[model samples]
Target: MNGRPVRVVENLNHALHESMLADSRLYVLGEDIADPYGGAFKATRGLSQANPDRVITTPISENGIVGVAAGLAMAGDAAIVEIMFGDFAGLAFDQLLNFASKSVSMYGRPHPMRLVVRCPSGGSRGYGPTHSQTLLKHFIGIPGLSLFEMSPFHDNRAVLAHMLGLGEPCVFIEDKVLYTRRMAGDGQVDDLFDYGFLGAGDTAPAHVYTEAHGDVDCLIIAPGGMAERALAAMRDLLLRHEISCRLVVPSRLYPVETDALLDAARHAAHVCVVEESTAGGTWGAEVAHVLHERLWGRLRRPVRLVHSADSVIPTAVHLEREILVQADTIVEAVLADLRGEGSPV
Candidate 1:
């Protein structure tokens, strides 16, 4: 919490601990969530021990886990239910869609059922088909529930605390691999601070841009792992003399606050949007449309976009990494945008 002591990895752990500490009603229910396993990635590592009754570990049935949580939410208690892995969430569709989402808007009350159905998604760690899946695309159209896509490890600590205090129903998806690979000893557990990759274009694939405003030829927007990779690609482009550029990372993907994206668009001569998801109806494509309609003339050059080609997230580690939108792919897109022939692969 002191000067530059915060790390992304540790920030996540701090969020859960702080949220629970602040609110006793915030109970945790999910398979293997109790100490030891810590719900697979140890996000809930110390919850069971610290809070005791507040952290209730559950059986393997994803449906039962969520169903119980939904009932609790409807009863005016919001519970943070982890869906274990993204793939297994299929078992609890009925509860997630019909019950939890509806209890909020369908009843026409004061937005009751304040619960968060959390999932750790995305493909990485080579866990294969069932485990390695980025299912955010499927939930994009679901109504009655707020969707939150978390990609920033440091901001997560504060964001989680804020979301809990709001008392609204939200599906918070945690990128599964972030547990070990990303989280370390961040100081967020001690205090709340502003952690983002979206101010004045700082972060790229993972770490946001830490620099002050530079003369950027273009602004590239990418979130999750791709955000850092895309920025790397932007740097590579600069190296090759293709162009100078700034990068904007919408660290939070779903329920994306357009204010930040619009600001990024306004700063650069042009902007390119990218993501590790589908092109049509995706968060990236949505951003491009917003720019075209709202900030059209503000940009000297045409709006640019970069995204993952429409394809299944493969199971093979090497192939999967290749299929994902990479830094080189983003650089290629920037090159195309430079020539006035925009190509977002």
Candidate 2:
């Protein structure tokens, strides 16, 4: 009614516009976020048109922008800073990690860090090394910041609205590949993927796609872009290998939905995690560790993590295919484990 129904990009645009109108102090600040430019992915297309003064554009300096945003938040302004790429998040580390994340606790301040850093993350578009990085693992374990990744099935408008009210600093990641993908449907806020078990609770995990009814051979856990590939691989596993698995995807990266994850893993014979980030000190690694630690007795096989190669992303498409976890790689990994030919992580 308010605007046309949209895919991921437009949905995010809608959320940003609504949040600004709802709160007087909330403003958007980033490079080229103004109209016509509308950010690197056009998620902020009409935002500057509506609120010309509030949607502030700045020079190219991640550190300066983040530092300014932190200062504004301390002065009671709710600011959303959009970083063009996840790889450049390292440049803003001093402001985010040291000041924004620790300000509330250190200063014993009343108002929390009313800041949100929007990071466009993940890669499959041959962006090469620096432009294509997840960098999520680097931001985790910080005491005060929240981490969120938008999902196609889950309602982004609802999630962003809630996050804006949290009164804490947040790192919100937007996958580049998801920008053009249409929403699965006008789904209910609680329904992750038309499945019943995972609801819209704050701690609920997303049910990406599942066939784990009576006997589940494996439970495939993936995040962001990996969820789509994992679901595709699952179809092959069922038809060709006759292996059934459940796909559990999480929208929130930090403050993980531990209970929901554990429940899903307990019912499966094997648990496998897939991620776009490289192996070792990755989000997938953490997931596998937790599942192994908690459900070791319940699990029939050791937890496995299939991830991108631990090196800079490649420029060539073929090299990328070889490095990233494609449908074949996923199918191969799962089937190898099922056949007892591969070592589990």
Q: Encode model 2's per-residue lDDT on 1-345: one tens digit a residue.
A: 654447788878888888888888888889999989899999888998999888989899999999999888888888999998878989999898889988867875556778989899887899998898888888878988888887776567777766667778888878788888765553322232244337656325667444335558888887766767877788788878778888877777787778888888877888888877777787777777788888887777778878777788888988977877798888988887887775544
Q: Can you list the residue pairs that collide in candidate 2?
A: none
- lDDT of predicted model 1: 0.66
lDDT of 1 by residue, 174-215 (tens): 666455444313412112221344444222122233233554
TM-score of each: 0.83, 0.92
Query: Which stretches of model 2 miss by more than 4 angstroms?
Result: 1-5, 186-197, 201-203, 210-213, 342-345
Q: Pick the candidate with the highest TM-score.
A: 2
Residues forming the 10-long window of minimal summed lDDT in candidate 2: 187-196
Q: How many backbone clashes does candidate 2 have?
A: 0
RMSD of each: 4.9, 3.1
In TM-score terms, candidate 1 sits at 0.83
